[model samples]
Target: MVLYGLKNCDTCRKALKLLPEAQFQDVRADGVPGDVLKSAYEVFGAQLLNTRSTTWRGLSDAERALDPLDLLAAHPTVMKRPLVDHDGQLYLGWNSDVQAALLG
Candidate 1:
């Protein structure tokens, strides 16, 4: 399993604590792999973009208007938190549903 998220994200930290076996890939330090990002985007659609994030808020209207993939590539942190990859299936967020799916 691979966890793509920021080290400073509390939700990510909580997920890492519970999923100790998952390899943590800090998205800020090393951006999500292109293939993985694309796959996640395909599955999650606009949900993959964290429009509420500080990065998103800081973006100019023009920048925000860019394709979500472009925004994510330029600002990795703008992607939603704790995007977990398990056996090639993508799971977004560390919510109860995800916890049950991953940890059960």
Candidate 2:
């Protein structure tokens, strides 16, 4: 399992603690690969974008209007935390449902 998120993010840190075997990928430093982002977008659609994030708040209206892929490519932090790739399946966030699906 590979988890994609910012190393400093509390949520990511918690997720790492929960799943010690999961490999952590710092999206800020390594960036999300094109294929991974494409697949994530396909699976999650607009849910992939964290519109409530400070990064999203900082973006201009024009930037907000841009394509989701382009927005994500330019600002990885705008993504919701703890995107997990487990057994070729993509899961977003560490919510109860995700926990049940991944941990249970």
- Tens-digit lDDT string for candidate 2 (1-104): 99999999999999999999999999999989888898999999999999999999999999999999999999999998889999989999999999999888
Clashing pairs in 2: none
Q: Highest TM-score, which number?
A: 1
Judged by lDDT against the true structure, how good is candidate 2?
0.93
lDDT of 1 by residue, 4-38 (tens): 99998999999999999999999999999999999
TM-score of each: 0.98, 0.96
Whole-model lDDT per candidate: 0.94, 0.93
Highest lDDT against the true fold, candidate: 1
* Cα distance off (Å), candidate 1, residue 23: 0.3
lDDT of 2 at 54: 91
